[model samples]
Target: MFNNAINAYQTIQNEGLSDRETEARVLTQAARRLIICQREWAQPNLRERLGDALQYNQRIWTIFQTEMLEETNPLPLEIKRNILKLSQMVDRRTMDTLTEPEPEKLDLLIRINENVAAGLRGSVTGPVGQF
Candidate 1:
């Protein structure tokens, strides 16, 4: 999970996005990865790892949102809304998984992440809170 986050961060940086935007994008990616892990891996240990990843992603998102909002150049509303939506999805998935997931559920989650990266990238510019 850490490796995935690192890879995502590196990818964003390689694209020349600002540090703040890169971090936000990476966290979003990490959250998406966790969603994938939760759906694909059946092992209890793997599920626990996914939980950890979710927690970490939530922390990153919270920090990013707060910092971005405080910046003189605030993030656009569309990006902020997307971030909130992603966060809510994580929360919902985690809550649902506390029990047991239905069949084909993982596939749905995989699809969610598959499209989220592009949407996240398209939502904002000039870093996460720099309008």
Candidate 2:
């Protein structure tokens, strides 16, 4: 468990992850873990693992929300606004899942994270609204 935490911290730390590709890679990996947790929540003795994954995902979203709100962030104004809106939705969905313990509630967040990560990697060719 400690090793997992250390690795997560390392992923979010300063090993050139500021670049778009690295950022997308980290987000995709983290999102994949969260997706797995959501899918496997019913397995034997996995409740704590689900909680840990959710918390990790929450932390990542919180960081993105905070960064997007900063005055000096370089993204276009419309993009920042939309991201901030999406972040709010993530916050709400996260709280709802925590309160209700419904794994299905995580699907939207999974799609959002995956879609954004894919967009960052330049693989998305369609409108993001469908995600």
Candidate 3:
């Protein structure tokens, strides 16, 4: 029992946060970057900040898409399909934002990230529309 406990502890230490937690953290970070740019819209570096934030969000969603597409991914088929659809929306919106450069346009992306993170963290007390 002691050896098993030690092995479990070692595994935890090596693995760190679970996949859900890691995903939630990354989503939160992406939301944070967008939020910063949204709030600092008047700043001189707003374009650069917004571009960076949008790219970061795109990268995150792209990673999710790739993971969901993997044969070994354990998520349900419906869930994977839904995530892929969502990533496509993110890609479209990101491109629109990049070309037009509007502050209000980031709102949907921010809410999406926050709501998804909340769901991943198992703290989604309300619907996505509420976020």
Candidate 2 — which residues are off by over 4 angstroms?
Answer: 1-18, 125-131
Please write out the lDDT profile of model 1 over residues 23-46, one tens digit for every residue: 656655554556556556777677
The regions of model 1 sitting more than 4 angstroms off are 1-17, 28-32, 35-40, 71-73, 99-116, 120-131
Which residue segments of model 3 deviate by more than 4 Å? 1-15, 125-131
- How many steric overlaps are in each model, in order? 1, 0, 0
Ranking by lDDT: 3, 2, 1
Q: TM-score winner between 2 and 3, please give it.
A: 3
Residue 80 local lDDT, model 1? 69
Best by TM-score: 3
Give lDDT: candidate 3, residue 57: 84
- Taking all chains together, each candidate's TM-score versus the true structure is 0.49, 0.78, 0.83
Residue 10 displacement in candidate 1 (angstroms): 10
Model 1 pairs whose backbones collide: 75-129
Q: What is the lDDT of candidate 1?
A: 0.56
